[model samples]
Target: MFNGLSAFPLTPMNETGVDEQAFTRLVENLVLANVSSIGALGSTGSYAYLSRTERQRVAQIAVECAGEIPVMVSIGAVRTRDVLDLAEDAQQVGVKALLLPPMSYQKLTDEDVYSLYQAVTSNISVPLCVYDNPGTTHFEFNDELHGRIAHLPWVGSIKIPGVSVVPDEAKARVDRLRAVIPKHVTIGVSGDTLAATGLNAGCEAWYSVMGGLFPNTAKIMTDTALTGNAAEATRLSRRLEPLWALFRDCGGSLRVIATAAELRQFTTTPSLPLPLRTFTGETRQRIAAVIDELELS
Candidate 1:
């Protein structure tokens, strides 16, 4: 489940509630594209903005739509009890794995994170993927902390945010991580722009935002990079430089992706939850141009 392209699709929504139809279409499209796995409620899925009932329903929809394709749902929340319940909810729907990011309002210590994993792992049956995305969570995990959590039962994979873009530095980063985690736990890289470098550096999986929406393109990049064709993989990533540039300039991928999705007619405007708006004006025009030029739609 952790290996290869694990696509994280958006949970598109509107004023009423979860846009079940659009969300289902996204999941069904990924299934058709045959991504290695479907990560339904990861950060790309706007997991943080959803209510419990909404999340549970999303999980059910993803599992149902994915069919034979493996489904991993994010169970990350600020509270341990909430995390536990979320994990159970995902498992009840027959999800293949769980992704947990150490989210906290108060700063989290290494011990706090380790204990949280220990508690959750003991209770859940599915494999757990450690989500080490500090940009949103505010909890930067040191290698020592990762080594500690990696030892717990059911620790299947570690989703590192992104490795160094430089080739040697990227390999060194993955090497250092591999030395700490158990051999059974695969190392997956997030951050779509750096995916080629990370994969060429030896990470086994990609927890990708782009893969969720544009599965065929992302999968080709993944398959190429994993096969050791460094030049071609780099070329593939370079071709998408326009999209990556948007990710860089816009603050993050969430809103930009939402805008792209809206342009493609996959979802309506206000695809994101309240208080967070998708791009408008010239920014939206630029994204639309990129989508057309790159044929992302």
Candidate 2:
């Protein structure tokens, strides 16, 4: 259930709150596109910016709309107790799995991280995916740590973010992780631009931002790579190069995806919190051009 393209839908927001209509439309679109699974309240979903009630609502909505497709919801929190509570909430809402990042305001030791997952897994009935996004969590995972976590009863997958900014090196990182981690545990990659590379390097699944809005394209790329159609996979990934460039230049994927969604008229410009804003006019124009070039609209 965890393996394959796990689409991370952007949480459509307005001044009032989450735009339920738009959010539903986004999930429905992924289902229509036939993505392997759906992920809500992920990094792309702006989980940290939302309230507890909002998160619950989002997870419920995702599960309701996803139907047969499994829904994995992020339940990362600064405190272990809070994480446990969120895990219970997610399970109650019918979420199939929980994605937990060892989030920390301060640096955490290996023991600290292990205990957090152990505590949640011991209590929760659902499977959990270890999200190792050092960029957001500021916590890194070593091979030994991954091995320990993978052996946990409830742990199903390990999401490893592409550490290298370069695509080739990022692909190498996926291969390295595959070699070190337990074979039973699926290795999922999160960097949108490095998805094809990661897949070609033996990563089992893609936790993708682009897949959220462009599931057909993402599925095609993943299938091609997994089937050993390297040429076609590379071709599909190259078509996304322009958008990927904009994603890198604009800081990250949250704003770039939101802007693209707005351009596609999928929703109103995503309402982000302070310290984060939508794209600039020039950036939007570039994104528009790429969208047109790829015929994504």
Specify the highest-lDDT model's number: 1
Q: Record all residue pairs in model 1 with backbone atoms less than 3 Å apart, i.e. clashing.
A: none
Give a tens-digit lDDT track for model 2, residues 1-297: 678899999898865789888889899999898888898999989998788888999999999999999999999989998888888889999999999999988889999999998898899898889999998999988988888888888888999886464657866776676676667789888888878877777778999999998888889898888898867887888888988898889888989888888888778765555466778678778888888888772
**Model 2 global lDDT (CA atoms, 0 to 1):** 0.86
> Each model's TM-score?
0.99, 0.94
lDDT (C-alpha, whole model) for all candidates: 0.92, 0.86
In terms of lDDT, model 1 sits at 0.92
User: For model 1, how does the per-residue alpha-carbon lDDT over 34-141 read when each residue is reduced to its tens digit?
Assistant: 999999999989899998999999999999999999999999999999999999999998999999999999999988999899999999999999999999999999
Q: Count the backbone clashes (under 3 Å) in each candidate.
A: 0, 0
